[model samples]
Target: MKFTTAIATAILASAAMAAPERGLASRVKARAAAARGSRPLEAAQKPADTTNKTNVQYSSNWSGAVLENPPSASATYTAVTGTFTVPEPTGSGSGSSSASAWVGIDGDTYSDAILQTGVDFTVTDGEASFDAWYEWLPDYAYDFSGIDIAAGDEIVAIVESYSSSSGIAIIENKSNGQKVSKKLSAPDSSSHLGGINAEWIVEDFEENGSLVDLVDFGTVTFTGAEAKAANGESVGVSGATVIDIAQGSQVVTDVTIDGDSEVTVRYV
Candidate 1:
């Protein structure tokens, strides 16, 4: 997950946003502080040092399943697609249970930055809502306002990095044929989005400097998921590795890349 010249790390250092109930920016900033060891938290609360690998927060993180590719210098990624049921979080504890499923370029196999988009499913106080969003890391994720994303909606999420810092994100509610597409620009070239990495993931983003508890999402499957490299090479999950998020020594979830581009994430 580590790439040469950690330019992207600069971008990742600023990408998180707080949950809706948590005064967004401040919460994200708090988490960032904790990630850098700026805050005093319990020894068991800190995420491990994954300086060169794909870093995952022991608190809020991409905690479900992930399939990631290695960095490529001349790669121009395009057309990453996936379909999944928007899961209702099983918030059995004191905090909300939330998770996000998305596809993007960078983050894993690169530095701190990423150009991505997907759907966020949240269950707060026993109520569930699914929303679609797109993000250029170092920036907050923006929800597609007019699009209605509901639970069990067959969704198709796509990200095409047309240029080094330019891309388009599309989210479609396949069941209703309602979709939204947005053009995005990464904040800086440090993103090194081109020829970096591509990922299909389920993440548990942090809020208020703590990792949010993950919901029992059961299983999430990413289908027809593939990327196109700058060299015109079709990228699949052939050599992709399974990424899991853990707390202490206990691995929490599992990911598997099957065949060429099908990926399944199961909650344990």
Candidate 2:
């Protein structure tokens, strides 16, 4: 009934996405704004009201861009570089009328945009909150993809953990020049006897509560990653950089934004 758990919701979202309805972005943005205290009208809405739609509107500072090697354009769902896919879950909660359970549902993955730590991407402020769904794709899952993010003038590394999930997933502090890892928690709850596909993964975040601050790779003592930005020898964690292939290193540090931790780029 309560889809506040990550594992419970991933099962429903794991399935492939169908064609996106036109003007869905605007609707999502409007809904997100309303949820974040920006209220919108709902009672006046009509049943046959499928007319014009608007683009998602956000405050100027809320905008962002990502660098990605995207999938075929024709595909309904595009797994941009920073974005990952989730396989449909087998177990869900769809029972009889007398014994029914319902969970929240949301389906929005990261888009193609180059983002880094401390860049006001994941958590714009030291304290921010949102109600939504997310997934966690660590290094082991993406082959160490989306690693070495920066906040501003730091090595882009931090340590954080999840509250509860059937399994464990955490990022650690630094060790040597590499970002060493330690015990981290994750939310892997799958509810409804794991037999539905319309539940949601819910998230709640608070500032400085089990939070870990991270620095960019250059600022860290032992990061093998080096930045190749035109402005500086190293791009700060917050600065934007492209996903270069000629950088001589195919081994990217493990980064996790699959929705486990509140922070985006954690050190593990």
lDDT, candidate 1, 1-268, per-residue tens: 8765666765555453333343333333543454311111112243344333343333225532333453354445555666777765665534556677888776654555677788867676676667677777766666676777777788888888777778899888888889899998877766546445677788766444555666777788888877777777777776665566566655566666666878887777
Q: lDDT (CA) for every model shown?
A: 0.64, 0.20
Count clashes in each candidate, considering only residues at least 3 apart in sequence or on different chains.
8, 38
Instruction: Tell me the deviation in Å of residue 266 in model 1.
Output: 0.8
The model with the greatest TM-score is 1
Model 2: lDDT of residue 92: 22
- Candidate 2 structure lDDT: 0.20
List, residue by residue over 1-268, the lDDT tens digit for candidate 2.
6666787677656642542222224324533343211111011221132222232211111111111111222211111111111111121232100000001111122211111111112322221211112123211111112233222222222211122121121222122132322332222233101101111111111122221122112111212222222222222222221111111222112221222211132112
TM agreement with the true structure for every prediction: 0.73, 0.19
Inter-residue clash pairs, candidate 1: 8-112, 9-112, 12-112, 59-211, 60-211, 61-204, 62-203, 76-230
Instruction: List candidate 1 stretches off by more than 4 Å.
Output: 1-60, 63-72
What would you estimate as the lDDT of candidate 1?
0.64
RMSD of each: 13.8, 21.8
